[model samples]
Structures are given as C-alpha cells and as structure tokens.
Target: MALTTDRPITTAGLAAQRQPERNRNVGRTLRRLPGYAAVALLLVVVTYPLIWLFLGSFKTQDEFLNNPTTSLPDSFTNFANYSQAWSSVATYLQNSLLTVLPSLALIIAFGTAAGFALEVLVWKGRQTTLMLFLAGIMIPGQMILLPLFTVYFQLHLTGTLWPLIITYTATGLPLTVFMMATYFRAIPKSVFEAATMDGASIIRSFISIGFPMMRNSVLTIALVQFFFLWNDLLIALTFTTDDAQRTVQVGLLNFTGQFGVVEYGPTFAAICINVLLILAIYIFLNQRVMRGLAAGAVKG
Candidate 1:
C-alpha cells in the first residue's frame, strides 16, 4: 500500500496560489490608467481658474497687470491686499453675520418643529399642510421678487437688513421643512408611541428625543442655509440700499466700484477671502453634512 500523507496549506503556499489572480487585478488596474489620467486632467482643468485666482491674490497691482499670464506672484508674503480688502468690507461682514445668524437660528428652530409636528404627531390636515410646504419649493424666487420688493418698500424695510433676514428665512423654509420632515419620517413610529405612553408631550419628546436623533438632519439644514445666506447677492442687492447694511456680496461689488478702476490684486484678494471662508466651513462640517444627507436618504 502506498503511504498516505497530508500537509496543511501554509500561508506562503496560499499566497503563491493567489499570486496570478493578484497579478491579473494589477494588470486590469494598469489597463484603466488612461481613464484615471483623463479624470486627473479634468480635475486640473476645472480647478485651474480657482488656483489662478488664489495665486493672483498675492500679486501686486503692477505685477498682475503687467504679467497677466504669469502664474506666480513676486512676493507671496505681501498681505497688504488682504488688509485693504478687509478694511473696505469690515462693516458689510458684520452686517452679514447679523442677518445670517438670526435667520439661521429661526430656520432650524421652526423648521424642525414643523417637521416633527407633521411627521410624528397625529393631526388634522397634516398631509395638506405638508403638501403646501412642499409646493412652496416649486415657486420661483424670481416670480415673487417684484411683489416682495413692493411689499418691503411699502413697509419701508427696503434699505435695512431686516428685509434680507426675513427673505432669507422665508425662502429657506420649504427646503428645510422638507428635509427635516423626511428625516423625521424615517424614525420608527414606535419611538413616538413610547413617548406618548410615558405621558410625554409632543414638545417634550421633540426637545429631548427628536432633537438628539435628528442631529445630522439639523446640521445639513444649517449648512445649506448658511451657504445660501452667506453667498446671497441678488436678495441683498435688491433689498439693501444702505451701504452700512450691505452684505459681503454687495460689498465686494462696491469694492470694485470704489476704486473707479479695478485693482486686480485687492479684488482677487477679497474674492480669495470669501472663497476661503466658505471652503473652511465646508471642510469643517463636510462629514456631518454627508452623514445627514446619507441618513435622510436611507431613512426617507
């Protein structure tokens, strides 16, 4: 009889056996190199203007004017442009904060409450109310511009930040409500039922349990509203006639006008500053925004 032998498969032997498969995968990856290269090229093309704008911010007026095609500035450390730009728009920046902060607070507070009431609480006309809110989203902002302006003008609010605040808050509501409601709906009905059994009021349940559970949705709403209010030029321009009440967008436009001739360095620097502020906010809250959106999508 032939001797029977059995050997355990060693790690090295297993790896050797898989080597061909690994090599095939690598070969497939290599075959996709042209696609990767094209994507990289596309990214560079899309980003080049922003990069140029940032680099141009560092150049002196003369350097920017004389060497429009040049990519680098003579002195990267020169911050005079930024200082000048800030000096020009400091009050406008303050006004922006004043307008946006309160509007944002209202948007989150009322939006979440409305969403909870619609989704978690049993009520008459809930579906109708939700339909109304959702319908508002379909209305064109431009369609209301003339009527809104007339109303604000009659109220003598045209030159003040109040109109901007009110408009921002109002325009932001439909989307906020929709997002929050979608998020709230994804929550199990049993959660609210348990609260009801415990003698918890709708307000109490919303404040305690709902708020904590919907943190991601709240962040998403906040981020969206923040960007809208911060970057708003059309509303700001239409509503605010006072220089002191101008937000950053109108302020930037005025900055160009104040110089009579455009000062490219300071203009670019101001643009860079605005872009950086938005970019910083996005970077900081990006994870939360993604989480909120994903959670809402999955749950809704």
Candidate 2:
C-alpha cells in the first residue's frame, strides 16, 4: 500500500519511524553482550593475581601459606615485608640499575646507528655484514656463554660489573638492530631524499629526520630489551662473583637455596616492585616517544 499526502505523518509514519528503533535495540543488545563479557573476563584475569599478591605481601609466613587458599591478611600490616627485603634488595637493585642503564643506552645508540648505516649507507660487503650480524642472533645464548666466559676470564674481567655491562650490550645488538631495521624499512624514501637535498649530512639527517619517525617502535624495543637485560639471571650469575656486584635477579634467585622454602612474602613483594618500576619507566618515556613518532621523523 502506498499513501502519499502533503500532510503531517499519521500512525503509519509513526510505525515506520519506530521500526528503526527496534532494529537498533536488537543490534545494540547483540554487540554489548560480547563486549561486556570480554571486559569482565579481562578484568578478572588481570586483577585476581595482583590482588592475591597484594594480600599475601602483608601476611605472616604461616598465615600466608595456610590461609592463602581463603584470604590474605585482614589488615595491611603496614607493608613490613617490603622493609625486610630492602636490606639485600637495595644493594642488588643498585647493581642491576648500574649495569642495565648503561647497557640499555649503548644498545639503543649503537644498535640504531648500526641498523641505519647498514640499510642506508652503501659500502662493500654490506650483505655479508648483515648476514654476519644476523648470525649471532641465531646462536643460542647458552652456547656462547662458555666461550664468552673464557674470553672474560682471559681478560681478567670475571667477578665485576664491567663484564656483565659489556656482555649485555653485546648481546642486545642483534635484536635491537633487527627492530630498528624493521621500522626504518617502513619510513618513506622521499623524506630521506628531501633531507639529503637540504644539505643535511648523514649524521644530521639521521638525527633530524630518521630517528624521529620510529620513536614509538624504538621505545617499545627499549622497554622490552631493558626488562630482558634487567631480569637476566644466567649471565649475571656467572660473571658476577663479587658480593656487591650481583644483579637483583641473581641475588634474589640465590635466596631460594635448592630447597623450596621460598621467601614467598619477599618474593611476591619484589615481583610487585619490579612491575611498578617497569611501568613507571615506560609511562614516563612512552609519551615523549609517541610524540616523536607522530612527528614522522624518518631514518635513512
């Protein structure tokens, strides 16, 4: 039926308009259910473990193990375990930061520079160089450990911070170069050409143009690499024999002597502290990195 009139809408017009409302209701119900369910599931997964850790941090050793199935301490207990762990934690953490911070800076600076040079600057045997660089990434970290140890021993470098710092920087290169290369490949070629035409030399072009564009990816890589080196246990354990030079992971790990009498309270507390520390570093730097990425700073 067709009804045409140059008049205001009647009941049929009202019904026609209401039909869209019905469809919208159906569509929204279908969409909202899955979205809410997924959100709920994610919240539980993230919050439960964090809450458990928080609660257990305050409980007594006996209370923690026995009542952990049911609940944590009724009151906060003023975070006493954190102070208890602080004695060893402070020194080891200082050692970790010292090694990790310098290694991280060298990795980012040298690695990004290496990647840019390899990709953009033409020279003899560039392919061979890249392949050789890639060759290291393929070798298992453990396989190189013993040989590296021999070299370190020969250099009289065992039982000190220098060995770990140098080793962390060396191992970090392969992956850092890989990450920088991937991002560099994605930048537009025109930007590099423009910078070159404007008379910006190689170093200036990279600093003024290329490095800005890949900031986000670089920060992400830095975060991942920093945490990787920071949490490393094996290499640090081997190279660090001086009581004061041991990294936090090596020191904390040594706490649990093959017998599983886990200093669970301190362990959980340290875990929480590590999470917060990493989060703080990323949060502070990620904003600036994102801004640099948004500026489209391309690398040659």
Give the clashing pairs for model 2. Answer: 210-298, 210-299, 213-297
Candidate 2 lDDT over residue span 67-134, tens digit each: 74557576686576787667777898899999999999999999888878877667898778788889
lDDT of 1 at 168: 90
* Residue 158, candidate 2: alpha-carbon lDDT: 84
The worst-scoring run of ten residues by lDDT in candidate 2 lies at 291-300
Taking all chains together, each candidate's TM-score versus the true structure is: 0.89, 0.81
lDDT of 1 at 242: 78
Instruction: Output the worst ten-in-a-row residue range by lDDT, candidate 1.
Output: 254-263
lDDT of 1 by residue, 1-300 (tens): 888697899999999999999999999999999999999999999899889988888888789667756558988898998988888767878999999999999999999999999898888999999999999999988888789999998998877788888999999999999889999989999998999899998889999999999998899889998998899888888888878888999988977645487888888888888888889989999999999988888544
Candidate 1 clashing pairs?
none
Q: Score candidate 2 by lDDT.
A: 0.80
How many residue-pair clashes does candidate 1 contain?
0
lDDT of 1 at 141: 86
Clashes of each: 0, 3
